[model samples]
Target: MPKIFSLFFLFVLLISCDEDVLPKPKAYLSLEYPKKSYKKLPLKRPYTFNVLKNTTIIDDKNNWLKIKYPTLKASIDITYRPIQNNMKELLTEAEKLVFKHAVKAEQIIPKDFVNTKNRVFGSLYEITGNAASQLQFHVTDSTHHFIKGSLYFYAKPNYDSILPAVAYIKSDILHLIETLEWKKSI
Candidate 1:
């Protein structure tokens, strides 16, 4: 009888110890972003004919506001400029900036027409590189306002690692386009 009681007590202790072993949470490749906290900032260039209200940022140096989701990350960069010298010249300058880091410009596709009361223009560009590929858009109110945007994804030298981020960032970019509104010129 004593031996059986001791065994029963030992079994209870073992069961209690097992109960203390909590399962570890699973690890995942994920990112988390805070709620949208957008702020407006001034542009150094006075040529900005119009600015987008929701797209403004406090600093031009850090052009894009970064957002991270559990499985992806994104950024939206907004720039506005009034029609200045020549439209072609301005576009050329913009192209130069985008292609600065590219080995070659793979393709350029027209995004959409920006038809406003004052102006009309379209946007387009696609660049491929050893490290990554970028889809760029150029917007113009035609007369005196031009805005250019690009979505760049980090990739390996072979252009493989960028796939995940690129897929997700594209959606964010589309969202930005859908929400864009022309604010007053600066």
Candidate 2:
């Protein structure tokens, strides 16, 4: 009886002396984006602008285009609408297109852009949160050309998971806006 009691005590002491177990540390996804080199898009339209070297421009109908990043599964859909005394209506439709994401967006930030030399003016919307589109913009000469652009991920919308891609593509959009020049002839 005394030997059994001593054996149990020794086993308990040895087990208790071992280090405590801990849960594994949480891991996060790390995404690396490439550096962007901007070059002017070769197109004959009322306006022209630069695009990221990483993108492939799929020829769309009329003056419209889709700037696609296949590796990232994302694309910027661009639509060109002629402004024939209907700038107000066109602008309203652009606004509505962005505001429609308000239900899922945490916030919609509008950055107004204007370049007198290029005669390009527009509002860029940065939609934060798990929205379908992370960015949208509309550029126009206020008389002749209207360009509406929106960025969409091919995958399901998850802001945190796709943020790196969004940030990388957003810079390209800004470059496009900055370099936009109205040729005023199709």
Candidate 3:
């Protein structure tokens, strides 16, 4: 009788231990994203702006595309060719735009230019409002056969809010510049 009671107690202890040994609840880690969708708008000019096909616009007229990583809180603006048409003129126009908005603007040196697989690119810093953000632009006149590209994140005035998205979206910008197709002038 004593031996039987001891065995039953041991069996109960083993069952309790087994119940406690459940597989650690599956650990899951993921980023949170907003519900988003994009539509192709009719190109009003000869230029075409192609987004990731997954972006969403809070408004079409404002040209705001909800960024994929909301933590970055970013949007892309694809402005068509303004009056300035050539690369030189475009650069000058861009400089003017930056200076107009920035309390201070500085042109980066050649050492700052980063050589990627295809194009040479540099960043210009502009301090506007109370914060400073980067104005990074890359040009590939050789491939596109014409001067064409974009000024990005112009609406983002906060450096902290804009920098992360700028960094994340830069690869996409490089891809866009790499795969650019120029409309041949008839």
Best candidate per lDDT, number? 2
Model 2 clash pairs? none
lDDT scores in order: 0.52, 0.91, 0.43
lDDT of 3 by residue, 125-147 (tens): 32423333344343433333223
Worst-scoring 10-residue span by lDDT in model 3:
62-71
Per-candidate RMSD, Å: 9.4, 2.9, 10.0
* Better by TM-score, candidate 2 or 1: 2
lDDT of 2 by residue, 1-186 (tens): 999999999999999989977999999777777777877897676778898887899988878999999899999999999988999999999999999999999999999998988888999999999999999999998878999999999988999888888888888899899999888456
Which prediction has the highest TM-score against the true structure?
Answer: 2
Candidate 2 ranges beyond 4 A from true positions: 1-28
Which regions in candidate 3 have their CA more than 4 angstroms from the true location?
1-50, 57-73, 82-88, 101-133, 136-156
The number of clashing residue pairs in each candidate reads 11, 0, 0
Residue-wise lDDT of candidate 1 within 64-132, one digit each (tens)?
A: 332223333334455555566788887887777666646554444445655565354655555554424
How well does candidate 3 match the true structure, expressed as C-alpha RMSD?
10.0
lDDT, candidate 1, equals 0.52
lDDT of 2 at 72: 97
Residue pairs clashing in model 3 are: none
